[model samples]
Target: MPTAHEVFNTRFVKAMNERNYDEYEALLTDDYVGEYPQSGEVIRGAKNARAIVEHYPGGLPQDNIDTRSTRIAATDARWVRTPTFTFVRAEGTGNVGVSAVRARYPDGSAWWVVNFYELRDGRLARSTTFFAPAFEAPDWRKPFVEQREAPAER
Candidate 1:
């Protein structure tokens, strides 16, 4: 049997890759909230979640971008976990961004989410994600200081 975390990850990735909002919606809870750090926006409810995933920039359906799972770490029971996602444009014209998500299991193994999603009876409830911003920094480095030799040693 697949764990909730595993199921959610697989479904989320598949839906995003195929741009299937319907499939994505089926997995989300009724009351869902997606928090975006870059935009500081919170998408509430399952309807909004579907909309957000559909209209996501450089996302599936609209663009031929690809999302790859770079790393995933889950507990022994696969209840709580974090997964790193890399979004890359299909045309390779845009920059690739990395995002991490932490999933929580409220019930057992039924509903799961990256953000906030209200689970059904005895199912996973709510998901709150903390998105990290992607930024670029110059490769400039400071010169290393050289230590002076003691005069007595010379």
Candidate 2:
């Protein structure tokens, strides 16, 4: 039997890969909140989170939408039919789980997505995700650094 945290982590990734909004919503608490620190955006409630995934590339429209609680900061987002997760690793203790994921988009772009998940009563209560694009090493540091092979694409 898997631990609660392990189960949550597995389900979370599955939901993301399948874009199963209903399953994802079921895993979150009613008042769950998610934040993207890079963009200073907040997603309040599971519904809003679903909206974000559903309206990818453009995010939630600014027209006739409620921004009193949640803010949309993803102006330019990429939508991929299939996202490959490579160098995947996750660890959890008790109610908190941290996942470091390398995702490859169909556009030949790779990004690091680190997620911190907090569980309350076996359900996700809060999540904070940070994203950073992969970049080539600067040539200026070539003399001081040793080259290493890039992570394998999945």
Candidate 3:
């Protein structure tokens, strides 16, 4: 069985991957608040969140999208620990992007959030998130290189 927090996070991830605006909207509360890092925008209410997702880059691209987890921690019923997300674009095509996110829950649950989102009667009232630039390899080509060793003699 999946926990409520897990279900919520999964839905959020799926919405982003599929670019299903309607589905995404349903997950958010009427008065949802969002803090976006890429555009330095603070959006209030479900309406604003939907609008931002519609215009945000990488929301859903025709190219391949891969989200890899480097680390994950969760409490029994409190909150989920930080999880580093490695987002790859056109993964095998040499173009990749990565982002790290740490979600904390005030009520103690892993809800796929960056800040404390206060929910009143299951309605979102306030939320916050801080974004930092993603990490990348200095030489992208290096990742694709395969090194071979010379033959060894007895």
Best by TM-score: 2
Off by over 4 Å in 1: 37-39, 58-125, 133-154
Instruction: Please provide, for model 1 over 1-154, each residue's C-alpha lDDT reduced to its tens digit, 9 standing for 90 to 100.
Output: 6444444455666665455668878776677555655568766777887776555432222333333432223445553222223222111112211223322122222221223333444222345454433223324532554444421111
Q: Go through the candidates in order and give the clash count of each.
A: 5, 0, 2
By TM-score, is 1 or 2 better?
2
Clash pairs, candidate 2, are none
Q: Report the lDDT tens digits of candidate 2 across residue range 23-126.
A: 97888898999999999999999888877776665333335544333323322354234454543677788888888878766455788899998999978899
Provide C-alpha RMSD values for all models, in order. Answer: 17.9, 8.7, 17.3
User: Candidate 2: lDDT of 101?
Assistant: 77
Q: 1 or 3, which is superior by lDDT?
A: 3
Ranking by TM-score: 2, 3, 1
lDDT against the true structure, per candidate, is 0.43, 0.71, 0.46
- lDDT leaderboard ranking: 2, 3, 1
Q: What local lDDT score does residue 103 receive in model 3, on the 0 to 100 scale?
A: 33
> lDDT per residue, candidate 3, 1-154, as tens digits?
6444444445655665455678878877887777656568778788888887677532233334342322233444533222222121111111111222333222223223244345444334555555433233357677897544412110
